[model samples]
Target: MYNLAKYQKLKNKINRIERAELGFFPTQIYKLENLSARYGVNIYLKRDDLSGFSTFGGNKIRKLEFLFGEILEQGAQNIFTYGATQSNHALQTAIACRRYNLNPILYLVDVIGEGIKDPKANILLDKVLGAEIKIIEFKENEDEFEAMYRAKAESKNYAQEISESEDDYYLIPPGGASPLGTLGFVNAYLEMKAQEFKEDLNFKNVFHATGTGGTLGGLTAANKFINDDIQVHGINVSHKDDSYLKEVAELSTAALNLLGIDFKLSDRDIIVDNNYVGAGYEIPSTRANRAVKIFAEDEGIFLDPVYTGKAAAGMIDYLEKGKIEKGSDLLFWHTGGTNALFAEKKILGNLLDNHI
Candidate 1:
């Protein structure tokens, strides 16, 4: 029931302007019948994990579709991005840049433990992509780190010293949580709606990891435009309790504007749970471990520690707590971080040993 007129018009425009080649075809949406029966709700899994982008399929590629388009259109031949040493966004951006014939300069900070010697996860894939990496000891907030990178980038000798200025472009933060990036998920909402309608089922709850806040915000705004009553729940993957509400509010408004839909949003539509985030970003939690093991054992599914595991844990906890009424259709979005499992396999050794 979206503003069909506006939705179609925007879709036409995106089709005309965006230069995205199909990296992934429709990721499957299948009913988790066993889980549904157990939870007393119609639960469905949106398998964004099947994206087929590269070594590790993920939801970031969807956002990168728009980002790379802008890079190409801007006549940029070199790209710059920042992230953790093992960041999926950094790894995937490297891949996208190579595919589009762009050189990538990755400024990875914090040459720390576990991620240094063992690049088995996304870090290994990043090296495979041939992205020129610069490792620095970043020891401050994002604003501070960004300021340092900007100062470094703006140095007269940076591009000249690196020989990358000829056609340079910049990529934003991890999760690619900008307005353009969020458009990818906004479109995803529409796609999901199409599938839902085709299957003749209306999902009441939509769940995903709220890392950078863009995906959840975009999906929520898209739901409003589509005029659907679906609730989008974001399980926090980082400490954004105070700021996430504002971020979602602002981004959702931007989404509404892009779709040309007239609507106002409140905080009630956005649900975020920080309880299961564990120690911090990229660190695994006991709850997440249980969820990952359960899903793998029961459903033959693989979820990573950083994203999918936490989100799934959040959904399961809600079910157990009776926060979600029984028999309500719930959708769990698998944002694809299965590769993170390989990085944390050491943590799973006891379980692995038992199984062996």
Candidate 2:
């Protein structure tokens, strides 16, 4: 437990930051009774999945609260962002942009095929929202991040070609994984802390999927701010190395700075495991597929094949290896992306059970 005075100070500081009202605040946390029994640990889920501004609720809503707040604050006329074709961040940005009457333009890097034109899950929703999109194809050996960088570079060229004024547009990184966006997760950490106190909750560890590292940043910042020692495990849904770990730490530190909190994050504060990224991002793996099935059967909760599925699989892996002590309290932060279930069949590779 942390000092109440310090806790209040941290909470107050976070509240001072500007954020657009986006999702429902303090989304519920509940014990996974049957899953606890099956896995031999006290399991709980922090449901960022049901973070509803719309029924299409997701973890991105939290980040968008701060992101859109900053974007709209600047009075930008056009919102430009980057992500994969079925990018949840891009879709949510479209929604937020429409809500404020600002036009949305997307520069999407294709993780699968040409995602922007594919008209699937998020891409389809992007179309419905009338977002202008540019699909960034992988040229030869260029990876996703490389493609993302190139996409950002091309965004300017595209903007100039379209004759959109530079001041009229704002470019957000993929996954809303910016320092400002990271503040959302920092807010989430505060929410969870409040929940922990109210219920006498004791989570020795917290697990979540990490993509562009925004959520990871927030979770780490929260723990640091409160001086809590929770072992927050970031299970990679895509390939990430030690450099990514350092970047996440840096991002968290930057986020704390935004809140007027003085804190420097180090490698010790960031924990990430890159082993669970099935085949790759947007490519569902057999292990992740089974994970989706088990969570559905046991908790009746749907985890998307792309992000949360891989995270659940990694948590289960640690459980199997006895890396986590028996009977210890563990919390899985459900950073939602269930939209992928309705995405292309490739993303839903293992969601189809033989019985069903």
Best by lDDT: 2
User: Whose TM-score is greatest here?
Assistant: 2
Stretches > 4 Å off in candidate 2: 114-118, 160-166, 353-356
lDDT tens digits, residue span 150-199, model 1: 53565324556555565565655556777777877877887787788898
Clashes within 3 Å, all models in order: 1, 0
Q: Write one digit per residue (lDDT tens) for candidate 2, span 1-356.
A: 65667678878887877778878889999999999998799999999888968767788899999988887788777788998888888888888888789889999887888454457788898888899988878999899989999999988776666645666678788889999999899888889988988998888999999999999999888887777878889999888778897899999999988878788998777899988997799998888888889899998999988999999999988888888888988999998889889888878875786642
Shift in Å, residue 124, candidate 1:
1.0
* TM-scores for the candidates: 0.87, 0.95
RMSD each, Å: 3.4, 1.9
- Which lDDT value does model 2 have at 58? 80
